[model samples]
Structures are given as C-alpha cells and as structure tokens.
Target: MQGSASSDFDSIPEVALSRIWQEGWLAPELRTTSGERVSVIYRGVWTHAHGPDFRDALVDIGGRIVSGAVELHRRSSDWRKHGHDADPAYDAVALHLVLCDDAHPPLRHRDGRPIPTVELVGFLSAPLDDLVARTGFVELGAIGHGACLPTLAGERELDVRAALREKGWERLFAKQLRFQQELSAFPPAEVLYRGFLDMLGLSANRQGMARLSELLPVTTVERTAADGGSKAVTALLLGCAGFLPLSPGEQALAGLTPAESAEVDQRWDVLRQHWRLRPLPSYSWTLDRVRPANHPVRRLAGFAGLVSGCAPDGLLARFSELLGEAPAAWETWLSSANPPFGSARKRQIQTNLFAPFAYAYAEVQGQHGLVDWVAALWEQLPGAVDDSVAKRTLRQIVGERRFPIRRALDEQGLHQIHHQGCAQLRCFECPIAELAMRYEQPVLYHVDEGIRQLQEEIGHEASHRLREG
Candidate 1:
C-alpha cells in the first residue's frame, strides 16, 4: 500500500533500486523463460551520452546494446508527472523504466506501439537476497569486521593476494582517470598540484582539504609571477592556508635565522591578503580526527617540496617506478628523511611519508588502489577460529552451501590441505580437516590417515599401561 501523499518513488535509495532489479520487481521488455536483462539505460551501448545530459540513450545488457531508452523512470506515471507526454522532447522514448509495474493501464511508445516496461524484481531470488543482506549495511562500520578472517590460513594467502592485486589496480586506474578529468582545463603543473592536494584531502576530511586546495591554486598563481622565489612560495602556501599564525615556539625558531624570519614576515602579509580575498573556510575543509600524517597541510607542504625539487611531468612516472618495487623498498623510500630544511621546517616535511608514493597512488590510482589494499590486508590478517576443526567445519559448511567464496579463500583452503590433517581422521567440526581435503567431509568425520594411526598407537599404549597397573 502507498503511504501518505509525501511518498515519492524518486526518493528510493540506489541500493533499493538495484535490489528491486535483483528481485524481479521490474520486468524487462526482452525477458524470456531463461532470464531477464541486467539493466536498462536510456542510451544504448553505441550512444555517447554524457553525465547529467540524459537525452537520446542506448540501453545495454551483458555488455551488449539491447535497446534504446527514449524515456526512463522509477514508475510509468513519471512520464506524465514530469510532463514528458506533452513535451516533444520525450518523443524518442523507446523503453519505459520502472521499479514496479504499478503504472496505471500501462504506457505506449511514440509510434502508437506499446512501449515495453522493465520491472526490476523478476530476477532477484531468495538466496541472492540472503547474500546481499549478509554484505550490505546502512553504515559501513556496522559490517562484521571478522568476515575477512578466513584468509589468514597458509593455504589462503596467494588467493587473497591475487584478489588484492586485481582490485587494487582497478582502484588505481579509476582514480587516475578522475584526476585527469578534473585537470583537463588547467596547465599540467597546476593540474598536478590540484590533484596532489585532492589526494591529500581524500574522503576523510573533505572540507579542510577543499579549503586548502582552492587556496593553493590562488597562491600558485601569485607565486609564479612573483619571480619563482621559494620565499614567496612558502609564504603564499602557509599564509593562504591560515597556518601563518605561527605559535610562539615557531616564532622563536624563525627568529633564530634572520633570512627565514623575513620570509615569515612576507608570508604573514600573504596570509592577510588570502583572508581578505577569500571567505573564511571558503573550501569548507574540516580536520576532525585527521592524523598528522594524513593532514592536508602536510600533504600540501609535501607537494610543494616535490614541485620545488622535481619536474612535474616526471613525478607520476617516478611514482609508478617506485611502486613497482617490493613493498619493503616502498616502506624504506617513504620513511627516509627529508633532503634538507631548518629544524622547525624539517619537522613539517617529515610528517608525510618521504617518497609520497601513497599520495601519488591516490592521485593516480584512486579508489582502485585503496580498495585493493583493503582487500589484500583482509586476506593477510584473517580473524580467529575455534581450532583447526572449526576451520575445516567452516570450509565444509561454506562448500556445501555452494555459494561463491571469494578468490582468496579458494587458494587459502587449498594451501591448508598440503599442511594440515586430512578429512578422514580429523574432527568433524574442525576447519583444518575441511581445508585439508577441500571441504568434502562433513563436521562428523574430518580426520586424516596419520591421525587414525596415532589413535591406534594410543590405544596400544593405554592397554600396556593398564596391564602394568
């Protein structure tokens, strides 16, 4: 039943929309007894529709263009509510999109033919729902933290590593594309600077990072014309970010060097100019719970140092080269000390990882690397289990369920078999046996041949002890 007048179909969450499709709530126009189409977009595969400009579109299914969407919506009546019926703009609507078939009397195509409606619910099954329910959460923090623990067994490591690498690369490229897109209009150097700041800001503290990013550009513009001076650059960056209000301790250190002290004075004036031109917190950047290493200021300073030291074009290539090395090498590069600066100034630069590989990856790789890293970490450090028995039991239970276990588990489970007891002689409920034999045995009979032999030997030893007594 529909709720009060305020219930609007457009308000549905994207997750719910996807679920509706999964659940077969929307009927596809091209459905057979076999199955339904995965999705229906207005523009089909050939059409080059840009974001927010949903004019003529082609729809796709399984990577092929199935049809063209002249019109799309959460419900059929949306066509009329949005006044598409009267507007000539919607005359090309080829498919009607809806979450449910709740449209009145159905709708027709512009050619006096009946437009096929796609309801999303028909494909979703109960098992799929269970799987989704297990994974989806309104709050990310609420997701079970222990879900990744199965990857820790020796058998699972390679599987886990492979998954991490694949996903990580995806995140990296996606982020790189986005950075390129954002910087399409700016000069290469400015583009790189903006991207570096954005990577530093990231999703953790959006407002603070944005504020710093906007100011950095303005400062850069001023510094370029101000004779390419380091003093000017330093002053502009520090002052624009509102960090010019040096603490008394910082002031005392600055006073120790007359040249540095004068630069600080010039920086203070730039800071004043920055405040006058831009509204306070123009970027709306926030610093809530941000670590010193992750701070936007540290990242900006680091970027400033990098730009001051190296050519912009070479930075990304150098970063990629560094990342191609072993993880230990990367750690060393990141932890190395700054080239040289005043004691007080050196402290600021040293806060960020020296190599800036992570930040570079963030700018270039983006979510792909982040997600892959998280996945890899998950595999390396899986959570606790009751025992080998419990591990084997879980492997069997999961196997019997016939669900898609992640790739990490497939490798880890196989690896366990080479090292642990076999299924015949181990405990039924034990995970070790299940893992050793590839999840064939149930909880009741998870033993190995070695374990059976040991049991016989133990029985003889017990009988001898009894006879002696």
Candidate 2:
C-alpha cells in the first residue's frame, strides 16, 4: 500500500496532459539530482520514427521511463474513439492516461509489440481542480474596460478606422453588385436609383417593404418601359402597400363599396401582371402600435414624392444636393404640409432619409469613418438623452462589431411602452456621448465647410449634365 501511494503521486491524466501543453506549463527542464532528467513522466510503447509520418508510444509508467514522449486527449478512451488506435498515424503514442483503470485492447507498435498504458486518476485530480477554479474567475471585464479608451486613442484608432473602411468598402461593393443583379435588364441609372429606394424601404420595414416592392414590380416596369415609367410603378406599389392614400380616382378604380375602396386590390393585381411578379415567401406587414406619421404607407408616399420630383438620371444628383443643404432646408422640405406625397411626420421622414445615407457612407468609406460620422452626428442631436435608447437606435443604424458605438447613438430617445403605458427602462450613455467628447468642435466645422464645397461641386456637375443634354 505504501509503495502504491508513492507511485500514484507521479501519475498524470491524459486530459490534464493536453491542457498542460496548451497552457504552456510543460517545458523541458533538468532535476539537479537526476542530472538532465525530465520531471513529467509518460508511458506507452515505442513505435516508428524519422519520416514524413513518424510516431512512437510510451504506454504504462515503466514504458514512460523507457521512452519519453506523449500525445494526449481528454481520455485514454479517445484513442479508440478517434480511431488512432488502429491508424498507422498514431503508432508513436508514448503515454495513455485513463480516467478509469481498464485493460485497453492490445495495440501493436511498428515493430509489432503490445503497448502498456497509464492510469492517472489519483495524480491529476487536485491540480486540475485548482487550475479550473483559478481560470473560471479571470477578470475579463476589467481587461476590456481598461483597454477601451486607449483603443480609441491616437494612431491605434486610425488603424482601426482604416481596417473598418476597407471592410465597409468591400461590403458596399458587394451590395452594389447584388443590387445590380436584382435589377438587371433595366437601365443602369434606373437600377441604381430604385435600388437605393428599395434599400431605404428595407431599412424601415425590412420584410414588409420588400414584400410590398415585390407585389408592385417597380424594377419590372422600368425594364419594360423607360426611367419615368418605373416611377409610376413605384407610386402604384407604394399606394397598394398603404404607403400612399388613395389618389383622387383610386376608389373608383378599386370598385369600393360605400364604405371601403377596392382600388388597393385591383391595382395590386394589375401591377402584379405588368411586372410579371413571382410569388414571394409570405410575411405580415407590421402596423401594431405604429404611429400614423411613422406608418409604412405614409413613408412609401414620401418615397413616391421624392421619385416623382427627381427623374431617375437626376436622382443621384438630387440626393447629393439635398444632403449638401442646411438641415433646416431639408427639414422645411420634409415638413411642408402640401408636399406632393401629402404630409408626413418630419422626424420619421428625416430618419428614413438620413439613415440610408449613413449606411451608404459606411459601405463606401469604411466602418471607422462611419463611426466618426455617427459620433459627429450624435453630438449634434438634442442634448441629455437616455443612453440605452440611444444605443439601441444606433445599433439599428450602424450595426454591431465594426460599429457598435454608432448603433448605440441611434437608439437614444425611443421608449418601450408596457400594456399599462409605463416606460420600462431609462437608457443613456450612448455612442452620442462618445461623439460629443471626440468631435464636438473640429468635426462640426469640417461638416459645415464640407457641405458648402459639395453643394458647389454638385451645382457645377449639374450644369455639365444640362450642357451634355
């Protein structure tokens, strides 16, 4: 019993052996008394060596003393489970650690000799338990918090931004290609412009707007006719999707009863045929608790108005122009009561317009630039808002990972209401706060000057287009 207890102290589990290698614990060292003796013992039978595929084995404790090397796994049983016991590849295993002592089947070495095995339960239990306990509580949160600010400072931030930009550009170019493929067989300008609108709609109601667009066939109309033809298709689609209120004779066309108009149904059918629509996967449009101003129908109407006002070829230029103007000027345009598409909620409209631009910028310039842009924009948002709300909104806007901070800014101010109409949580300390700190002065000035320069460039470019015409 005393001799067995002395030998048990030196035994090691296969699982612990693998862990030792992975965690950098096992290094070749000498014991002074033993004069170059390795401390860790392994046991298995010797096999082949010196080739493209060489292997050996150190089976039981006595075998380890004879030949010193080991490959390990969670259990000695894995040897058979992984089929290494049968493969020529594992002929060189030097040690086998078993959780339970069992007579493993005899395996032949290259020279065709039976291999020995080691039992490690008593040797490994205490040390492995201590290791697991220590690692389980490692302070990851402290590390992340400590690194956050330094990560955003100086050239480190710039390098991150550059990597983000490259990734963003790749994503944008890929999307541009996909959009083109979606609208292929139509004119390039019509494809580009309508793709932009679809992206806008997708941003708002994802599945709903996509289903609505599929039903209306804006791209199909553009393909069959010319540029402006697609605008009519866009209106019809938006109108059917409840984005547009019935046009003057829409009720008559729909064959509605005294109370309700059938125009939506009839027009949906006609547009479907004209566009050669295919059946899309079914989805329900969400209107539950949605405000009238933020309604999909109203937003679609605004989109229609914008398309009607700017012909397809001029669409890009018009967008650049609007973006180049004062926020006040665009706000006034959006808020106009008698605008062609009818009145819309000013905030919703601004969000729909600005959100797409941010996505587009991120796609083109890279995520780091998007981070800067979002932070700059958030700094300019109304002051002292809820941080959580800002974070949620910004997440919807920019995305996660490449631009988590930007998404945080966009979520500000939105409140979730319970059945009893009570606000649940107060969220704040968003990306906007970060932006305010980072670019409060220089970014604002740059944006103001940049807008002025862009307006001039767009105006000059427009004159050139007119001359070409």
Candidate 3:
C-alpha cells in the first residue's frame, strides 16, 4: 500500500504521505467520505512491519476513544490488492485512508466488516510531499495530557471545591434526566426491578441482568414464590439468570457448602414446576475477570432474597421505603442477602440506581417535597467504594494538595468534570482548568502508586473489598 502514487494525485511517494498522518499534519478533525468527523488523539508510532502503516494509535471517532492500527492507501482497492482486506492480523484496524474514492464502494475487511475510510483528495490542498519536506515529525508527547493542571495549581482551595460542587449538581441533573427517560415507559415496579438487576450487574453484566429482569419480571417471579426460602430463591433466580452450572464439577461446587448445594438442587426442582420458561444461554452471564462473590450467581441470590423478604410490600415499596430510611437500613438488608451483597456493592447500587429512580418516582407522583429530599440525601450519601474515574480526576487536578471526595455527589461531580473536561482536554472552559492556565507550563502530576499516596495524605481510605468466598 505504501508505494509511489499511481496517477491518482500526481507521482507522490506514499512513504512521505504516511509521515503526514503519523505526525498529525492533516487537519485535526479529519472528514471521512461518509462525512463523519474523525479526531486524531495520538497518531501512533510508525511501524516498519508487514501490517498497518501505524500501530498503537489512539483516535476519537464519534466520541468513543478507539486504540488500534491505521492504514493509509493511495487507492481504496489497494486494501484488496495487498491482501490486507482478508488478513486477520489487521482485524483491529481502526482507520483506513485513501487518496481518492475511485473504487465504486467503500473498503471493507476480508470478513466483510466495513472499515471507516476517509478520502484525503478533498482535504489535500498542497502536494503532501512538499508538506512532509517543510515540516519534520513532531517531537515526543506533543499531545500532552492534564492540560488544566498548570492553571489549577495557583487557585484558592475553596474556589476549586465550590466549582467541583457545582459540577456535582450538573452530574446529578444529568443522571436524573436519564432516569426520567427510563421511567417514562415502564410502570414504577417494572422500572425499579429492572434498575435493581442492572445495578447488581455493575459494569460487566448490566445488560445481561437487565435482560434477565425483563424475561423474568417481578409479576412472573411473584407467582412462583410459595415460601421463597433463600435456597429456593437463589435457585430460581440463578436458574433464570443462566448462572447455574449446566454440568457441576467439583471445582464448580468449591465455593458452596454441601448443605447449600443440596438446598439449591432441592429448590431448583420446585422452581422447575412453577417457572415454565427456558433458561437463558449460559454465555449470557459474564465470568471473565470477575471476582467469585460478585459473580452473577451470588448477585442473583441476593436479588432473590431481597425480593422474597420484601414480597408482600412488593419490590418497589420496600425499595422506596428504604431510601427515606437511614443508610444503615439498606446495609442491614444487604448483610442478610442470600449470598450476602457486601456493603461496598450496596453503596454503588444506592448511588447509581436508587438515587435517580427515587427522584423520578417522587416527581411522577407529584411529591415535590420527596424530590427535594432525595437530592439532599444523594449529596450527603457515600459514593461507590471505588471509582476509577475519581482516582484519575484526583491525579489530574491534585498537584500538591490531595483532593479527597467521600460524598456521592462530590464523587459524581468529579466524573462530570473528567468526562466533559479532562477527557475532552478542554482546559479553558473547565473551572479547574482556569487555575491550571495560571502557569505557562502545566503542573507535573502522576498517580503515585495507584492513589496510595493520596489515601495516606488524606488519612482516609475505603479499604473494603468483597473478596471471593
């Protein structure tokens, strides 16, 4: 693909053109033939290998940051001529560049997946070879990170906290808006049940859990509840969730006691008669890199226990009543759950799921006072036990002073600043970024030993992790 240009745009060597892309010479916002914007973050190191022209490139296509290979071709069909079209090695390619769209249709992978192709013909004004000759490759780390740190270092401490608080409110309203949309269609009970299941899924299996909630609704599961013992509850829920082992070996049964195993099997039989629907595919649950206790089986058991314990009031009522009560009340119920959902997990669920829905429920029922109350409680409540974004933001803004945010609202606020501000590298618009601008050079900051230094500096660290049983 990298050869002398063949009559498409004069005889320009592609080696020079490849350097144009690798060094970020083209407009930062590249326009594809299909007219979508492609923003280059890191153009990646040029490779002399047999594959893509560039490797390890980071690009922002449609807001999602993609890291992969970038291929450059004089003509779109060169992809096929070079055998890259059918090569599995290029499977991770994120971008394809061509001088012209002389080929009838856009380029596709060997597997027939359409690769994003951007035509450089219209964007190219001067000859690329001249541009390459004029400008040498950009120096190391030209695309710098933490653009706002230099400015934020000189600001008063109180101003920064106030800005964070304001950003936190922005995050709350953003979440509330999303929850309002979710609640618009489904009934309160249906929405609440789905939300809880989705919460239990955490980051990995939220979609699977949501699907399970939809397939086996509260009404459907309510019909199956006779006594709804913990063993029976876990069996029914896990069976439906597709977490129950299809063929249990000794290793599969390692975590459960013999009594628990017998109880689950016995309860599963009862569920077989009441629940007539087929179980979901075993692959529906996420297991890779998941801790044992936080696995779908245990979360399902906890969900079943919560539903069984709070049945008469219904899941919605029990959950709603709990939000208004003390935080200890939520932890108390979590403590006795079938597989016992840890307090750390409960806090994540409470902040992400309950906070939004609680406000939405109150708003729908015309309880303005309740809506106000939920907002107040959300700000004071503790956030997730651990949030990666919070740690990242802390490192970005925290120069010498350690920024420790324990409250849910404060933590959520930092997330907004990170996503909207830091991720975008919008140093000027970001409130903290303004402070960072005071210095000509950005403050040098690094996450010291994974937030360990920050924890020691603040003298407070949430060290609670639910280890595998």
Each model's lDDT comes to: 0.42, 0.40, 0.67
Q: Which stretches of candidate 3 lie over 4 Å from their true place?
A: 1-147, 150-155, 245-256, 426-429, 438-469
Backbone Cα, N, C clashes tallied per candidate: 59, 38, 6
Top lDDT prediction, candidate number:
3
Model 3 has an lDDT value of 0.67
Q: After superposition on all CA atoms, how large is the RMSD of candidate 1?
A: 19.1
Tens digits of per-residue lDDT for model 3, 138-171: 2211112423353443446566667777888887
Over 403-452, each residue of candidate 1 has an lDDT whose tens digit, in order, gives 34333333334334313323321222223323423522322232233334
lDDT of 2 at 439: 37
- Give candidate 2 misplaced runs (Cα > 4 Å): 1-204, 213-235, 238-270, 278-282, 312-314, 336-388, 391-469
Candidate structures ordered by lDDT, highest first? 3, 1, 2
Best by TM-score: 3
Ranking by TM-score: 3, 1, 2
lDDT-superior candidate, 1 or 2: 1
Model 1 regions lying over 4 Å from their true place: 1-152, 183-185, 202-204, 218-228, 249-262, 268-299, 311-469
